[model samples]
Target: MLSLNSSAMYTGASALSALAAALLGTGTFWPIGLLYEAANVLVAIIAAAAIRERGAAGH
Candidate 1:
């Protein structure tokens, strides 16, 4: 059975990243990071709005 531990997750991520880098090349990865950051910001904004609404509702 596979454990959902930190080391397992780290190794999995490392492997995926190496695969992506090998397939996509280094220069392409840098520009793609902007899209990743944009996605992160969008999720954070939505989560913050949801939390604020929940707090306003006294939950």
Candidate 2:
């Protein structure tokens, strides 16, 4: 279940990044959104990786 949520978050981050890039290319103020999403994505990935590592270590 946690993994699922992480996956969703990662997906959302990817979408947000894409949208922000598009907006920026169009000469808009999308940096804030892009930074926010990128951070979320990075956090989600790190969390997921940590969870997997712990599970693998039988902790």
Candidate 3:
């Protein structure tokens, strides 16, 4: 749940950063956008691990 929440937040942030970059025509937002994307990937990995653990425990 926490992972999912974080993923959602990071995804939102990334989208906003992209929009800002597009509007401002600056490369500055690119790095922030990349960072957010990386965070989202990490959160997704954590969520997958948690789900796998839960499934294993259930069986």
> How would you encode candidate 3's per-residue C-alpha lDDT over 1-59 as one tens digit per residue?
99998998899878977766675676465666676688789889999999999999999
Query: lDDT per prediction?
Result: 0.73, 0.84, 0.81
Find the candidate with the highest lDDT and give its number.
Answer: 2
Worst 10 residues of 2 by lDDT: 26-35
Of the two candidates 2 and 3, the one with more favorable lDDT, higher being better, is: 2
Best by TM-score: 3
**Runs off by more than 4 Å, candidate 1:** 1-27
Q: Clashes in each model (backbone N, CA, C under 3 Å)?
A: 0, 0, 0
TM-score of decoy 2: 0.50
- Predicted candidate 1 versus true structure: per-residue lDDT over 1-59, tens digit per residue: 35667777789668756766664766467655765576579879989999999999995
Report how far off residue 21 is in candidate 1 (Å).
12
* Candidate 2: residue pairs that collide: none
lDDT of 2 at 18: 88
Residues 1-59 of candidate 2 have per-residue lDDT tens digits of: 99999999899879977877777887767676777777779889999999999999995
Cα shift from native, residue 58, model 1 (Å): 1.0
Ordered by lDDT, highest first, the candidates read: 2, 3, 1
Clashes of 3: 0
TM-score of each: 0.51, 0.50, 0.55
